[model samples]
Target chain A: MQMTDLPPAFVLFAAAALLAFVRGKARWVIALAAPVLTLADAWAIIDIGASTVVPFMGYQINPVHVHAATPVFATIFCIMLGGGMLFALNQKRQVELPAAFVYAGGALGVCFSGDLISMFIFWEIMTLGSTVVIFSGRQEGSERSGLRYFGLHAVGGVLLLIGIVIVINQRMYAGEVDPLAFRHFHEMVSGWTSLSWESLGMWLVLIGMLINAGAPPFSAWIGDSYPEGSESGSVFLSAFTTKTAIFTLMVGFAGTELLIYLGLWMALYGIVYAILENDMRRILAYSIVNQVGFMMVGIGIGTELAIDGASAHAFAHIIYKALLLMSAGSVLYATGKRKCTELGGLYRTMPVTMWCGIIGALAISSFPLTSGFTTKSMIVAAVSEQGAVMADLGQSHNHLIVAWFLLEAASAGVFLHAGIKFPWFVFFQKDSGLRPPEVPWNMRTAMIIFAAFCVLLGVFPGPLYEILPYKGVAAKFGATVYSFEHVMQMLGLLLFSGLSFFVLLPMLKRTETISLDFDWIWRKGVPRFWNEVAMPILQTLNRAQKAIFDFFPGAGSESRLPPELARRIGTNWAVSVPVLTITMMLLLYLVVYFVVPMLT
Target chain B: MSDPIRKYLNLNDPKLIKWYWIVGLIVLGIIMAVDLAVHHHAHFAKDGIDIDTTPEFYPLYGFAASFFLVIVAKTLSIALKRKDSYYADD
Candidate 1:
């Protein structure tokens, strides 16, 4: 196969291998060039058709193909990787850069995967890569956190595999064409309310994607694992996994009604947890869930505009979230502090970092003339527009109305938690006496690149809208995205929320503490039960067994045992003895039955 | 790290802090006033939820919602908050 004909992910993988042995300036060249090469490879296959297919086990698996949403997601993934690599140029941890490349490559690979098997393979590869990035943090608790991260994704991967197998088997049984093809589950959209056995495979697949999407009950994993990564490692962690899940959900289970409720829950859950969080990175981590929740709602709405909104929002979110983390990561890099309780007043020395951070904060809050305003409003508009359609059909549309109000409230809450809380505590709160110098040039450059994109995309959204899955819908919405009323509404809401932040500032005070999340079940509750409850009972059972043995003849614990008894209790055994005894018994039975019958 | 830039970016300066509050509040007032003049077509007008279209509804909702969320979080924190080392001790 021609070099260009290979899967785009292979370029990054090759770089990763070279990075393992290569050192010095050569590492930098590979790190920077790989992402650019992958970007070119990604953009080259924008046409929606099979580009590369490999036969395996009598089935075709296309590893290089474009879906409708591929162009936008692929473009952003490449850009993120490039920006992330630049930010990490000074990172001394060798494993981190290589791991990050593999992670980004896996995400890009998913964007081009045309079949379920290929998607699952890339999905697991992402899990492996991200776990290493977390491990490469070399933080005190990183190893444990990385294990937990891997464990959760492993379970999620298994669920996805099971679902894919069931789905492919059912398709084959029904003699469907291209049984392995990864596409929308129209049955999920049509029979959204039903939870029958026939649709169990699709349900498993949705749950698997939802777990990675940071949906509730499993959402705590985002906060639990992401913050443990090194500064730059967390930036890479924030971009790929959740957004890839969003891409998969949009493609596979777009109109599932359940995502609406789950998404709304995640949106609010993230805000509450973030408000109470003191760790700056943890706060950003929670907000990732909150942001993904908005994308989930759009996917649930599943109109052409809503799908476009979800895709466009993911594209914008990856950049701004990375920018936010880069700012936070810069702080961590400069001061070795990730807690707001311990960090403040570095903006004096780090003006570039501060301004970039503030820009990210504003964009996240969806302030007018920022990336969020132009992108997130589309999801909100999609909700109300869908409500109108439902009303016209005389179906129950109350839920859509509620979704709209909750989303608006969430927009304001995003301002409260991330937009103001992150910058306010980390940069402007009570001075913790830290006067660290600005982060290095590479990090600043990365932040500025992303910050510029945030503003430019907001001011001119036409280019981004042009690459959306439903370009017509997105373009039409782009025209009204900056409408006078919408701008006023967003401004009024966000500013007043800023007011609320200061008003409730006393309650929102940072403590050197963490609020309990659902993860406590595994992190504390299960282990506690095993140690405190189950272990003692098993020990007692062992004692009781020993007591019974003590009462038997020549088997008493205090007595000198015979050779047979000693062999049994002392764990002495020979494989040939047991085999010989059983063989002799079987032969005797055989002789008595067969020979005596012949003599009679 | 230099003197000129530090002076501009430093919120630790009492003078700068005062200006920040004053400028922030003024911006808030302008936004609220502008919002009152803008007509918001009700998003769920077909469903008769015209309260959403009322003058300055978003600003009010924004304030109340955030206030409520902070209050709820603080209350939950009383029971749920643990020292950051809670898991690390394990």
Candidate 2:
């Protein structure tokens, strides 16, 4: 079929079957083909620009007219889907292939969706598909994690629906017959719009997106669930969901001020929790939040440079994060262990995996000659320029400076914990006698491809810069301050953190236990408090009901009692009936006497 | 054939330790040389490109001082490895 003639939904439907039917070599080919096909479709649709049409509910969904930013995000989503699919090809599980493809398609659907209603429809599908991917781990922990994951996402979907309804209703009240025909993208981009029902719609949409991005409170679910997924399943889990939220945020809420603070909090929270974590995967999961925080902050800054930085960071982060996780997953797959304590000395056998992991780690930490450095520098430089401009107005820009500094500090922490700590402890530290062979060639090939991109983007950022929405920022070669300062800061962090780890090394070791977080409210505290406190109250209520039933058997029983005349003798019946009738008449007389006078 | 250094440091031997230190120093030296020689770009011309000596130069000086502090901190970690698996028992 001609590329333009191929509908996006058609691609999804085809991918679904391809993912379901294939196994072994056939499965690998199907996995690889699905993404390639999706990418091609994405490119074709994006180029045609609202020209490509598909029928949904009797309405023609023109993807080309969907808004300028949608295509950019859709393009990246396609790339990530392809990369993640390739990464998962070597794993034996059949379920993850279909689950991941459906998940990717749902996200693409969201990106190309022209209206709020279409966006909400695809949003829920993405949630269900991702939840299934998590559950496919086939572990008890995964089952529980999947439940929590779905619960939070369901709530987010509800909130998003409410907001969409409100916005549509307001549009209707304003005399617009079709809410979907309203184009608010220009207003959001201009930043001059006032707060109204429409703006409230924007806030609701932002919260919904942040929930997926793993923002705090709601953030715990990503860390809780993604790590519990099967080694291969996690590769799927990592790519689509959070990045999709970021894509939405970029399109819908860029330049909003609240996102800046939210992003900062997420960045710091990730760093703090990661520092306290012992499980290798959880640490990486937290780092995902940390990395997304940078993008969030960039989107919030709203400058052309800042948005560009955010976009570039998202692209870089997806590749490197997946690479990191795959490396960890390989270790888990090979050794059947996930904790840092139970792992060591595998670098001898898994040197290829080790090096691949380190490259990913370095890229994540924004080391020079890595994708992270190329992209993240744009955000920091944008912040610096903002500080300079604000300083001329006689206002303090200390907060901006501090935020930038914290970002730098977090970068150091990433290297200390993830970059160096992961590879060093799991592969090179004290020996644990593990001798698993190198990972399957397909897995290694995926890692190598990602690692190559990490370097390629870092050494040459021009391609990314060109595609970025932001136009003003300068991200090019030969800037010494950017490179030198970041390197020195990273080194300093390493030195200090290294010293601290040694000083507290006695306490830093992994244990055969889980660390508590917000999930603790559900996992331990709530359950314990209920058993010790709420359960007794329930028991008391149960006992009272039982006592009431026992005391008045017939009162609560099914059988009816005989009438008074049947129970009594004839004389007794005559006297009781006359007495009862007289009592009723007298009571009625008394009621009339007292109640009639009072009414008057 | 066991080496004396292996017994003390629990590393491979004196040969390995010497090699590790040599390689590390060589890498560090190369990085420093590159930083000093290739990275410098004069912010101002000799007379034409006006420069703020106080505001610009001070931060650079402060950065240099902090950089040395980091190096010293790293040197302290040599005392820190702690008889391997110090926390392993817990």
Candidate 3:
């Protein structure tokens, strides 16, 4: 019954279960109060050193524990949940709220889980919660996209579970104490080049996390499904999954050498795909991949400063990305259109939304006076800091050097892809004559609060920097982050990049077309294969089985029974197909269990 | 039905659009000058971080990289572009 024993995740989960039965004003009150209460309880636990262990399954597990980085991620998650729920206040989708609770609940569970078993259980819960949220979009193809989203995450979840089992077994075999303890993967990430059992387990774990973080080939899920959500569903969708993956990566795979290469590819990949993309939400979705890439490089750098940078960047990113999505959602709610080709010249009517969208865009581009500047700058600085350390140590840190320049270049590209491009096209491009008013007050209020945070955190980053993993390192870098020289450099780079957009204005024209991506493999390739190749083979096999059965006389079972008796039985219990299937499967399994033992 | 806000924001007007570009050019010029006045030091330069110490290194890289990304995306469009309905059937 102790406050310390209650993991923050369960708090929302309890609320979710409660929320399903509540109606009207009571529901709204609970939605807001759940996060507020969880935040209060979470902060209390944090104050009590955040160490609370429970014994389950013969393991003493710490489900609510804090690392140096935990506070930063946990804080933003609470803030994001609060703001997201507020934005969704007026949404009539009955299931979206409770589903969001479960989604956020699961991610929160992962944040506090102190063991691999606990983490895996929570991770699967998140996949279910988010898939339901996508299905609740109720748009065209919502169910289908939700299915694909479910399928991909299910694959990721299986990889994670298998990795967890292997790593735990390996640790136990090595005679380690507390073998399932969730701690940093220093051995696996730092020494991945040497192939071994531990490294393979860790590599599997890393791949599983990479899939959620929207790292390439898998990056299409964000764009594919996020935009399909009901406007508010997307706001909730944008916050949890990828950012949680970043949190896990920062915790586990910091300093993994290959991440820098993967991160750089994501950075460029985000920009290129966004440029070719015609839908506004898809553009933002690509940029989410892009921003997460920045955080990945920071973790890959693996310095205290870099880790802090990654954590803080994740903190800042959730708010702004959600804010951007909120603005896009606002547009969708008002206009019922989501493509750039269909939206324009509404800045006159929707000044509040336009300004909020602009603020979010600027913050994402790391404009000097926004949260992106205060936070993302640390990661950029971390690369340089790590490069310096590497040079002094006489180690091969050329990757750090390459990473720093690519990051800076990517920063410029952010301005092009998201900063100006999002606001410019959606709000002020051609006059499509759609004159939607500003979004409703609750939605506007949410956007404004987040927009204010974007600017406030930029101006005063002390609160955020204080909570970063290596608190002192981030605090020290905070001063340099806003130096006149650095600010000028960022302005020069981004503003000029803005000019490049205008220079390429004619080339950047909107079209009702989508550029190909790795998703083509799944969305088109898999279905086509199933239709053209697999289905035909299966149909032929089916015909052959039917022919054999037709020739087999009474062995074809139905022929042995009277047709009238069979028809009577079928007609009587046709609704019990699932029951019949389960009974047969259970009988088969039981037979296998007994016979296998005898055979052995 | 004249909207005052639209009147102020309509850069589609030729004169207003001209002024917008002119102001933008002036602002970029001013910021470029500001970069000159500040003594920019490279975080990695003391440890032999060479290329970044060059004057306006970030600016040039930013411009070139953005330009490069745009051109690449455009080129990719020629091959990768499909009608918006390409996946609608699925």
lDDT of 3 by residue, A482-544 (tens): 888888889989999999999999999899999888989988888889999999999997677
The worst-scoring run of ten residues by lDDT in candidate 1 chain A lies at: A571-580
Q: Model 1, B1-90: lDDT tens per residue?
A: 578877766766889878989999898888778887898999988888889788889899998888888888888889999999999896
- Alpha carbon lDDT of each predicted model: 0.90, 0.68, 0.87
Q: Count the backbone clashes (under 3 Å) in each candidate.
A: 0, 4, 0
Candidates 2 and 3: which is better by lDDT? 3
What TM-score would every model get versus the actual structure? Answer: 0.92, 0.78, 0.92
| Highest-scoring model, lDDT | 1
Interface RMSD of each: 1.4, 10.4, 2.0
Score chain B of each candidate by TM-score: 0.86, 0.33, 0.81
Per-residue lDDT for A255-339 in model 2, tens only? Answer: 7666777788887667656655667888889888888888888877767777777877888888899889989988988898887
Worst 10 residues of 3 chain A by lDDT: A571-580
lDDT per residue, candidate 1, A304-422, as tens digits? 98899899999999999999999999999999999898998877767888889999999999888899988999999999999999999999978898899899999999999999999
Each candidate's DockQ score against the native complex?
0.71, 0.07, 0.63
TM-score of chain A of each: 0.92, 0.84, 0.91
Candidate rank order under DockQ: 1, 3, 2
Compare the candidates by DockQ and give the number of the best one: 1
Off by over 4 Å in 2: A1-10, A51-72, A176-178, A181-200, A392-398, A471-507, A529-532, A538-555, A559-600, B1-90
Q: Provide the lDDT at A23 for model 3.
A: 89
Q: Candidate 2 at A180: error in angstroms?
A: 3.1
